[model samples]
Target: MQSVTLSLFRFGPLRARLWALSQMATARFALRAIPDIGTVKLCGSGVGEGFTPVPDTSVYAILATWPDHNAGRRAMFGTRVFRRYAEMADETLTIFLTPASARGRWDGQTPFTPQDITLDGPVAALTRATVRLRSAGRFWKQEPAISRAIGKDPNVLFKVGIGELPLVRQATFSIWPDTQTMAAFARADGPHADAIREVREGKLFREDLYARFRVDAVEGTWGGVMPDLTRRPTSMTNQMKVAAE
Candidate 1:
């Protein structure tokens, strides 16, 4: 019954954006005070579909874990920090998820507890890594190609690059219609696959975690468009294709 929430906030106007940036430090205090909230991370996005050095000042994300779906919803909709964020954002999207599979660790601690349930519909993939300082240059060089590959993929329902720290600590969250499609992108002969090979062969990440989740629900809109998880292979594909075009 454990659940996770990934909330994306888009701020408009210089003041709101500045406030969002400040929350990167200040929100942690508020989040820590929440009773049922477990592991929480406030992340900043990178430019143009993420995986870059330049920061996107307008967008930020909150990733939190809770005891159950109800607890997660309460924390998101009822907590002071989340309420303040909702009041200021131009548009926001929150995805409710149940971990289906997980491995490795974040900040040396496991964040998600996977359930013994089958994931048959839309699945989300999250990968977080702390890049080695010496491997930073090589890691960054592959980012553009990797971003371009994922950007061109029609099977990807949603994707964004976010990180706890600039440059060194990086993470990606993506949604696909099913696990097969998600795995296809990773297994394909492309920049992503190449990067995976290098990461394993060269020890690029100092710490890393990869997790898959069942998409329980999606709320609100991202970039003025609400992601409809109800529509499966057909409509979703068409919608994404149109967005890409």
Candidate 2:
């Protein structure tokens, strides 16, 4: 599966409306023409310190996954619909492509079991959760501790931008061995519980958005990339194809 994250940044109060417009436009095109496209997941809009904050006039969007490079290239370059959406943006657009190798599944509402998650394809399981706290002011002080606690967990792949924006104070992105592991972390309320309490008691961020997915495809850099270089290694782009085969 080919996975790509398109992040748009908008500045000013019209951010939300502009973002909504882009989403609506993209959804229409994706639903009709984008093959193997999964659910049109909406995230990062809720009020929380850990969420992505757009300028009062700025907005952002994340697009993940296409079946292959051709499909991905088609959606971004060959298609008029996506190009039109790009024209609506005011600032520079950023895109990241990564391969998603399925590790597991998340069965909503129940404790996830090993048997419940499937890794039948080259798909990555993507799950995101967010909560709004009552005391965002005090929560800012604990950013260091929060980052430390999260980093201690070996299962977590990466956590970036700690204490960056006031509205979206913290954001974490990680890869797990399987769905069961991810579920265990979610259900076993220790560190997670403590963090939730901190947010709630401190009134940090409000609203929690949670989602899990079976990554169907990925595109772009699978191995890695060197930004200083203009040309990417052929092996990196083809990594997913090799793995899927």
Candidate 3:
């Protein structure tokens, strides 16, 4: 089973923050050498509303794919690269997912392999794009409104704006109770909808990807507490295990 893991690390002290920042470039080497690892990205989050020109600097993410659940778990919990980030961060959270549907590419490579099974409960959506140089200004101009809209969106169970590069390359990951609620937000009349139209007409991105996933399980804490998983099925709930801190 193809699995994807998004590991978030939140740093507290200046030293830890700096180390996290430096690893955005330095850690890739270690990640590439890891066994069973597939596509990987070292991402930084946007400041405040979470879609901005400025980065938060304190929060970072490692998005990786694995051959199966066991391999993903081993890498996240056992590898030196992951353990180092965990040790340095004040808080950490990792979510495991199985792709339900996916299209497009990231950095010219398709990262997720979709499963044929239907998803019934909590769903997660990941969208990534590399803004064309000429379209950067136009792309970012929509950010304030889109960020505000998403921040105020009540249907979103969880959301974060993270990217490999600030400004030019960005991605947003959000969880919803179901696919219907998630699609409503995307189709609704708003800044996000407006931006979607503009992107299509303008051909704003050099590369882009959109994927929907079934939330297999999640471990650890985000913002100092675990995300409520009561909405997920008992089968997935049974799979949840808090990773050693």
Candidate 4:
């Protein structure tokens, strides 16, 4: 079973500490060196948007698509580069997901193939965009409003903004209780709808991609707390135990 892992790291409160982590730019090179990884993207957050920029000065994340569980586990624990990351970060939360429907290109390729997932629990979604310079101001303006809307939505389980470039390239990773509820939030009259309309009308993005997945397991805490809608809990313990060994 191919698996996608989104791991977020919170370094600490010092600006210098956050700046020091920029060394990750060089370390990410090691991820590409892994044979079992199908695709991997090193990401940070945007300014006002969570998907702001990297060397984020506080937090950073990795979105990796693996061939299977064993491959991901081996790399997470066995790799020196990855071990250094864990050693530095104050807290790390890694979530595991299996794709149900993926319908876009990520860096010119589809990293995940849509699967026949039928899970009735929390569903995760990832939306990424490469905004054109001309439309960037408009895109940034709409983000905070859209983010507020998402925060207010009751169905939201967990969400984060992550990106490669500080402002121009951005992505959002969020989860909901189910597909229907997730769709409903998008349909509701809010900044989300407004942003969509504006994005199309303004030609906001040079490229954009969206995908939904079945949340098979979440193996860590985001802030000493698991996602609110999590349906399975043991996955974290099992994965942690393996890492500890």
lDDT of 4 at 178: 88
lDDT, candidate 1, at 217: 70
Clashes of 1: 0
Model 3: residues >4 Å from true position, as ranges? 48-50, 233-245
Per-residue error at 101 for model 4, in Å? 1.0
TM-score sort, best first: 3, 1, 4, 2
lDDT of 4 at 196: 88
RMSD of each: 6.2, 8.8, 2.4, 2.7
* Order of candidate numbers by lDDT, starting with the best: 1, 3, 4, 2
For candidate 4, write residues 1-245 as lDDT tens digits: 77888887777857535553565577667888887887888876543433443335676788898876556767777898677777887877877788888776877888887777686889999999898998777777767788778777777888888888767878998888888998998887878889888988888888888998887666556777765555766666477456546
**What are the lDDT scores of the predictions, listed in order?**
0.87, 0.42, 0.87, 0.76
Best by the lDDT measure: 1
Clashing pairs in 1: none
Looking at model 3, the pairs that clash are none
Cα RMSD, model 1: 6.2
lDDT tens digits, residue span 1-245, model 1: 88899999999999999999999999999998998899999999988564678888999999999887677777776778999999999999988888999999999999999999898888999999999999999999888999999889898888899998999998889888998998888899988999999999999999999999988777789877888763434344345334434
How close is every model to the real structure, measured as TM-score? 0.92, 0.43, 0.94, 0.89
